[model samples]
Target: MPRQTILGIESSANKVGVGIVTDDELIANTRATFHGAPGEGFRPTEVARHHQKILPELIEAALNQAGISESSDVTAIAYTRGPGMGAPLQAGAVAAQTLALSFGVPLVPVNHCVAHVEMGRSVTKSANPVVLYVSGGNTQILTYARNKYYILGETLDIAVGNCFDRLARVLKLPNEPSPGYSVEQEAKSGTKLFPLSYSVKGMDMSFSGILTQITAQGKKLMNGKDTRWSKADLCMSLQETVFAMLVETTERAISVANLNTVLIVGGVGCNKRLQEMMRIMCAERGAELGATDARYCIDNGAMVAHTAALMYQHGVHINPYSGADYTQRYRTDDVNVVWRNDVLT
Candidate 1:
């Protein structure tokens, strides 16, 4: 029997990526990102256009890197379907559908959030752990139960990545790689931890208040009028405060679920400070912490392809001829995880 080869496309946000993978090996993963001005965020329309413009090249590059000249070599095509900007999601969906139809292969629609969790699990080999999913568009505590990822808690307002990005913009920080990355770099030089709003209600967390306070402070500092805090100081305080909330909530969730392992996924999961905080919490509780580097944690086609490969092996797929669809409000708990059947040890 021939090994199944899956091609994945991801354009849920500013990055457009393509990946090729076999059952147990990653062949190629390529991406193109759109960067806006330092103080401006990417608009949906512009991001969609960027994906559309660069997707073909990314696909070709991925296939070439994988040493597959014919599209027929691909067993399936998978793409991110929802819980992202609608226009960007549509760009990827349309490309996936077109590729699937042309190649005469199955098309799989993967939930972005589920892809992140599955990728983290695959990378860390974490078995039956409570998940802390954090990114630009989402923040949630999840655990698997009865073939579904149940959400234990989530953000009440803005996501942690968004909060970081907003603060970066206010301070006119470079958005070259990402605003969050820039903030993290600056935070390393911080000497003082300023007091900031920290809101964690029960299991749920909120970052809007912190963002608002930090944004105001950042603006004043950027205008060269405020001497109360340095850029590094502000960045460090923001991370310390928000990461504490996340750590506290995750600790509570782990305690309530009685789980011994905690897995962190999504774009913001790449942060060293956040990982350090989570590590401390897990260590204190005698639990283990699992996380992947940016290659797997950040939004990329590899994760989508990897998750789709798992689903395909389990006979989960859709018709290629049907209309490709996507949604901006797809929740993480909406996916019925048929591929996972692990028993907690």
Candidate 2:
């Protein structure tokens, strides 16, 4: 078969990313993130504007890095198609549509969640693994079956990353690189693990209570009234408490599915502590663990491009003029896994 090249654009949230990929190589992967003020979270409108302002440059840079001089060099243009903020998702879709039209190529819409999973598989070379997808917007345990990713468990209220971000705000952590990163850094120095609420109903988890407790504790710490726990200790306790819940749920899913591989993806997957905890759990079960660094763990276009290339290869694509639109609440299980032929082990 001839080689195919795909250009992927991702603006599902605060980051705008562009990636170029061929059948055998990742030609380019570039991105820019919009950092909100300290203690302030990103709004959809502001994030969309940031993506719009930076997308063109990122696209050009990606293409240049791949040594492609014209849009025609790309076989297809793929963009994140949803389960994200409406405005940010639209920003990427518009760019993708324009690129497809300008290049006279097919336009592919990729599920943001599926992209993360595929990227994890690609990077880790895991054939068929149970997925632990934890990000700012999502937290789910999934396994592939019958041409779909089945959700074994998920967050009932707020996601794990959101929990960290909220606590980061309460602690007034910097949001420059990321709130989660800052929280992770602080957690490394934490020596005490306060008793926080652990709410796990069946396979679903709840983090709102934990966030609330930490927020109240954070206020007291900031006021120099809570000498029992420092900021680092709070961060540490949160990580320990939440990560334990995730590990417990993931282990259950792995056993239920009888899968030997566990792949962790998403922004929070970049946390070394989380990775360590997951690693220990997988090891205890005699299962292998797969994960990617921040570049692929966070929202990025390489995963999208790589996934799109797989979809395109499997005859999954739409005409550029089909008036393709993004869906804000697209679920991970909503996608048909047409590109994957593997079954659960």
What overall lDDT goes with each candidate model?
0.92, 0.93
lDDT of 2 by residue, 266-307 (tens): 999999999899999999889999988988999999999999
Candidate 2 regions exceeding 4 Å error are 343-345
What is the per-residue lDDT of model 1 for residues 131-218, given as tens digits with 9 covering 90 to 100? 9999999999999998899999999998999998998898889998999999999999988888887799999998888888998888
Quote model 2's TM-score.
Answer: 0.98
Give per-residue lDDT, candidate 2, residue 283.
91
RMSD of each: 1.1, 1.1
Number of backbone-clashing residue pairs for each candidate, in the order shown: 0, 0
